[model samples]
Target: MSRTHATPVNAVDARLPASGRLADRAAFEAFRAAATRRWDDLWSVERMVVSVGVDSSSLAKGAVEVLAACRRELTGSDAVVREVSGNGALWMEPWVEIKRPGQPPIVYANIDPSEVPALLTGSLEERALGVRDGDAFGGIPALDDHPFFRHQERIVLRNVGVIEPESIEDAIARGAYSAYFQVLFEMSAEEAIAEVTASGLRGRGGAGFPAGIKWESGRKAKARPKFVICNSHEGEPNVYKDRRIHEGDPHRILEGILIACVVCGAERGYNYIGGEYPLAIQRFRKAVADAERLGLIGQDVLGSGKSVAFRVRTGGGAYICGEGSALMFSIMGVRGQPRTKPPRSVEEGIWKRPTIANNTETLANIPDIITRGGAWFAGIGTEGSKGTKLMTVQGPVKTMGLVEVPMGISLRTLVEDVWGGMRDGSTFKGIQTGGISAGPLRDDHLDIPVDFDSMTELGGMLGSGGFVVFDQTVCVVDFARYMTAFNRYESCSKCVPCRLGNPALVEVIDRIRLGRGSLADLALLERTSKHIIELSLCGLGQVAPMPLLGMMKMYAEEFRAHIEEGVCPTGTCPISVAPSALVAAD
Candidate 1:
């Protein structure tokens, strides 16, 4: 779309000190006191409350206006109305929770403004409290008990949808910065890095590089004024994990950044978010301001004598800006393009200084690793890939939204059990993982574990954890052409292979689809694809041929049918036909 950069506002003007709101320790004490009180006292008029967390507020059409209408209509009512952040369950929003002290929360999904009046008046019969048959328990099923939620291990998404995005108090109440505090006061920088290395935490962006090794590079580098950049430019199509995390749990990200800064000896930090994500930009900026005001990010942070300056910079909506070197260049007000490595971003980056650049989800895992210790975190997921992964499931699935599952879960379980199988009675054909860069896998590969090494072994990379399902009706050849077109558009023109090769691939696929291809064209396509893969400069160019390569290998019969038979096996492509007059003459 467009590119814009913003400097963070000074901490003083951001907001009032967080002391005015409830701290985590104080919140726990208050909860304890409220628990022992009588039911009548607990459910008093002052305690009646309702909260809404409209997921995908910005992208979900009319959701923001609907939320505003709900708030306005609830004005002057005995119940307290509060707006919260969504829990990554975009399909079930606008998710609402109505609670009275000592009673279970009454949850509702996909609520419209027209239903608010009746809901506030206690006309419960007119509204469905849950999305599915077993979703309602007593009033509404506990959020954790839902099948979609029960299978997840929410670390980065811990406070999401449960707390207000802009409220530091609400965040702390849910243990937002507890890990940061423990890391700051109890653990040494070396100790923190050791813990992370032991946890086997890898970068969640795409490349599964170890987080500890990256931090250690910055630590050992002989440089001053080291920097850490939070790579929040989530530009991948059909992936919304980073945006949802920033919108729902901004504080957790901030806390993670602070922890990274401390461990890596970074005196300055920048959260580089994409310009397309206005809501994410706004929320993260506000969160940085709030943290600064509370001494969580500025000089003399939390009275620990540690100092760091934090800022938020927006990036142009280029796909390449997601790369570390390209992102650093964007921050420096240059063209957002990738640079050759040897002196990587960790060694000499951001004005030729040592920098620890990490993705949003990677940094979000830091606080938990610090507090729980490395071995505890390592206990989850596969031996090579530890911790949970946040994935976006779309396409033909019955349920489509953001989901977090521990690493090593089979794709079959995720598609069938988590997503509830395909929609419209469709049969599964294949799945595309790691966004557009990775290859596709057929139904037989569904049983494979979704870890970094395992996915690599299956000729795919879990690049950013985007799982899109395809049904029996999909033509693999057409899908490859579409993906190649996308790669052509986003190639950055940095190298000849991606810039020139992708367009060439698209043309060949189109020729084959339109009944103009020969046996020679198939050989040419394969040769050209291999050359592009071998000669590309960046990951974008390197992975450009994956979709086409994958399709040719997995569905060679489909390609042969199009070339030899001149008909689309899946009936998705149209064939040339004789004119009506010509048919009559015949």
Candidate 2:
């Protein structure tokens, strides 16, 4: 563990103030008491800390070459390297951790960069993977008893992977704008909308709805120029937990969208996001320009004359701009689709006036329901679904990453006891918790209960969570013709049953997976999936035929074995197709 060189100014970001602006709430509680004394002197105990995670799936599995091999091997040693945030243990990509000085934090996994000098000489205790608060070091086990983070449950990923996200003073030294400094000095906006309607909060971007009745109807929509966007436009398809909570805690959803722009008086706000999330739009535009150069959000903010203002628009690659009046008409640049609701973006939005979107995990659970209230965040989950959700699992789960739990946890305990099942001898065959209009549970609907009215009572939903998984090597009629060619190429076809019933349910699930024939083309793929779910306009042509009509009503014998005994039962579809070297080159 060679590191005797003590001098690397602002080691990796946390010096904090470059300009000015925290002129109120007693100068932001004396700048969060000097950013909690340099975040407890960067984790004291004679210093050694380190961390190194850097997300986006650990920067495609290397974490920037383990943060340039921990600054080229703990540059001068007393070690306190930085760049944190990927604690979802993404199947252990790069990762790291350390702690030392008297030991405690440990971690290590999938290392490399020539194994960081044999992981600083402890010679990589078999790539650790444990040891957070104390004990179980080399024998590796405690990271809350591992098993991919034993039943997750973190509140908005509590300072996601432990702070340093482009440091807004390490997120106000880990307390980040104390609930926007008690709603900018001792509450009101109707007690933060009655503590987020006593915290039974919803709309985790899958339409659970009730976020304090959509901010008290955008604070009684009398409208003096209200707005609050943030629907991040995350073009779904196995979503990435709102791109890892916008690269692990973008100022906790920008202090829950600046407490929903002070309970909806909303001077302004926006964060449309998706341009395929280039690192959550380059780490939320350096956290809204270091929270607007410390005023803690533009003008009179912290000094509390009460203004508001936020920016970071980005998105243009539309997935119907992740809906919500097409993400407030793609932040007003327009043509992002979804409209006709008489007057609903909290009473006419964007250029018409009042609005309030809130998605990235529902404004990341509104800064802990305004710093620990609302019955302590509605005493955690279940009961019309409160608190945590995040989810994102992905395929053959033996820890595919991201999870937060607590909302009537079941899906057989988030895939067999918190992500530790289905990767051995793989053959479970079902799950798709939500995304691509979900609904495909199997294995007796894996014990149900994942909230949002028990996944909308099994017609299936709980969407934005995006679990996925599947097996027996997949082929439910070519997975309903690749989810109807991805909802007919992201249908913003304005309307007309998704502009012609999702290309006629992808040409009747591609002539019933190829072997042609048909009971009237399976009754015209069930009445063109009930006329595109009864005349679709929005909600993507009404759940784009709920995953090809829930895989023909639960794999109707794998769509009558490729249209009446032609054969393809999990042989991954083939039936009467050309291939003996393409029929001897035809």
Q: Residue 475 in model 2: shift from native, Å?
A: 5.7
* Residue 104 displacement (Å), model 2: 11
TM, every model: 0.89, 0.41
Candidate 1 residue spans exceeding 4 A from truth? 1-46, 57-61, 125-136, 574-586
Clashing pairs in 1: 3-316
RMSD of 1: 7.5
Q: What is the lDDT of candidate 2?
A: 0.78
Candidate 2 Cα RMSD (Å): 17.6
Q: Least lDDT summed over 10 consecutive residues: which range in candidate 2?
A: 577-586
Clashing pairs in 2: 3-77, 5-76
Per-residue lDDT of candidate 1, residues 1-586 (tens digit) = 0011121111111222224223344443453233223222322434445668855553374556656766677554444556677777766777667765545567677777777767766685445454221245555555666657778888888878766788675676566777777766777889999999999999999998999999998888888889999999888876889989989999888888888888888899889998888888888888887776656776666567788899899988798899888899999999988888878887899999999999899999888898888998899999889999998887878767788889999888888878778888788888888888788888888899988888776677788998788888888878888888888888888888888998899888878877788989889998999889999888778888887887788789999998999988887654433222111000
Model 2 TM: 0.41
Residue 397 of model 2 has an lDDT of 75
| Backbone collisions counted per model | 1, 2
